[model samples]
Target: MDNSTLVKPFKSINRWHMLGWLLVAQVMVAFIGRSLAPLGVLIGQDLALTKAQIGMLPAALFLGQSIASIPAGFIVDRIGSKRLLLYLSFGLGGAFMLMAISSNYFFVLLMVAIGGVGYGTMHPTSNKGILHWFQQKRGTAMGIKQMGVTLGSALSALLLLPLAAAWGWRMALLAACALLMATGVLAYRFYRDPPSAEPHEPERKISWSYLKESIGAMFRHKPLVLLSIAAMGLSGSQLILNTYIVLFAYEQLGLSLLLAGMLLVISEVSGSFGRVAWGIISDTIFKGQRLIVLVYIAALSIGIALMVTQLPEGISFWAIASVVAVFGFCISGFNGIWMNAATELVPFKQAGIASGFTLMVGSWGVIIGPPLFGYIVDLSGDFNYGWFFLSFVLLFVIVLLLWAKRLANKETQHNKGV
Candidate 1:
């Protein structure tokens, strides 16, 4: 069915519109992941984890996500995004519940790693859902959907610390698990994949022929590669912000631990709305051109600059939060933009794999950038240098954005009627 036909069914009662609610479910899952950061200090102190051991938790998740992304996308095509996310959310929720009860570091890592493997399915599946359901408004649809990550993390930051304090870390993890399980139940009930116009996008399936074609097509697709590169630059910069801002605030900005942690939470929370606002504005405000990417990069750069403009005068917590929020918002806001862009750039057949490929490349930045930022902080004796590194990364992103714009325009014109 075409867009018009799809719209007709939902005109009356979308009481729990599958797509909108699915987005909410995704946000909740992401929130659980994001909320865990504040607990790093708590986990360290309570569990007697050293810095290296504490660092391993985040790494564990990243590792699982990185390893699983490609396969997750492939599996998503066969199994469906809803089912994939349900399993992951369920696993992670359970893992957190288990984490609440155990203090053994290895056990904690194992549980989190298992949870990470499950959580890995979310990005591609959620992005694919937007592509399937909101074809014309893909960019904005995706932006709002992608906001789940920032919003979840931000919510976790604001609530988890206090909640954990009131109860305990274990209780916090169990609560997160419960929320995810609820989301999974909702997904199983309501979500349905849209029927593809071409049953198999390439028209024939069930053979090595499809595999060979996908590989050949993947290698030949230059635009997606370039998009991936641009995304990597964006990811690199954001990774720095995500990983180091807390340390930067405490050490370089001279904020107390509690104040700095709050700033971290604020940044993530700002990211959630930033994603929705920017996504909406990109197509509506920026004219759906490649220019939107540049807009995002610019937003991110400004936010980073605000964070780094350290005078001897102390920064207020709210002032820092405002700056951090802008940075977090911009850093995360563009995720959906690129996710949407992939559908149009690649052969329709390969669009589904785009999320996996893009995330795999983008996540390298996350894996590598944080530690590098840490190294810079260690070397310069100030956090200012880390912000500069991110600033530099954004400049590279600008070039990619411009290139992507040109490519997007050319393709849109070429395929105007097809």
Candidate 2:
């Protein structure tokens, strides 16, 4: 692949405008996924869900993402991101609306899982978009784009909680579904693929042999494999915070539902800012050393998580909020760096597949983390157990990151010697 193809500006479309819609798409999909953060209590009560069952709600959504992610990556690399985003966004929104009509927990779980199929498209499609659009400040651009996830989660709390309070959680989901589909339509109308330096073969063709080679190569890349393992820990920590923070504050701290939910908003809002800050740090201070930043994030996550487990019952609400804010900033703010690192390990043409493959592995954390945390909570009747569990997960990830950094350093030295 020609290196010059990586950064060519489009004449027909403004890259910044395209970035805005990509952010909108990211925010809306995340808005749907994190809806459970605020509405979990109401939904659990209405559906008579057990604690483990509540955790399964988000887990099921990520299950669908795990299932479809690799294939979605191939499709995005083949078909162009705009078309896939349009299709997946509309389909995902419709799947979410199905929950509005059903009161049965299993039925709603099925809908969320089905919607997860669409959620699978988000990272790959948006990643390829950013890769094609910006290169000089790619870290900062990716960070701004990745902020959609936290921003969406924060918005879900801000907008949906009030709507859920006024009407019902189902109504809140319906409103989210409507907005997501509308945004998809606008994205389709406006988003354009960036100009390619490889004019004859801008997009790769999909074939069984091609898929096999890409998959095999991805697994064989030691840095990618190690990073993928670290990604699982990051994903686990992130989902745990998104799934349980509100309830933890409510049940453990004896805060009101509305007030407990605001903790989620505060955490996600801080996470939203952290995404941008981490990106700038990577681009400037770290000079593209993303893995070191991730290592730092994991270490910070362990410290904050351990601290959470040790907090006393009578702690002030503001103090708890401050802790949640830092937790979110560390745990929720890692995707941009992780995704950028994964995509960078592969050819520019295969960036979508690399990201998809990485997320497929990471989605296991999404699938297992929440339910496991909830199960531990249920068994012990203590939210502290869940925090301890996340701390241990991140601790293991820090070890993996150290190993990856060693491998990267060796590879750099070998290249220099050559």
Best by lDDT: 2
Query: What lDDT tens digits, residue by residue, belong to model 2 across residues 1-418?
Result: 5645554445657778878989989999888877876888889888988778999999998888877777786788778888987998887899889987898888999998999889877988998888888766887788788778878888889889878988988887888898889888889988988655245655545798988998898898788899998999898889889888878877887887788888899988888777768988999999999999999999998999998888786678899889989998888888889988888766688897788688778878888888999999999999998888888899899899889888878887887899
Evaluated at residue 413, the lDDT of candidate 1 is 87
Q: Rate the local accuracy (lDDT) of all candidates.
A: 0.69, 0.85
Please identify model 2 stretches exceeding 4 Å from their true place: 1-20, 73-86, 123-144, 185-207, 280-289, 343-354, 411-418
Clashing pairs in 1: 31-152, 35-156
Q: Per-residue lDDT for 299-404 in model 1, tens only?
A: 5575566456563336777777777777777785666676766665777767766665676667776666665665665677666776676777777777776777
Clashes of each: 2, 0
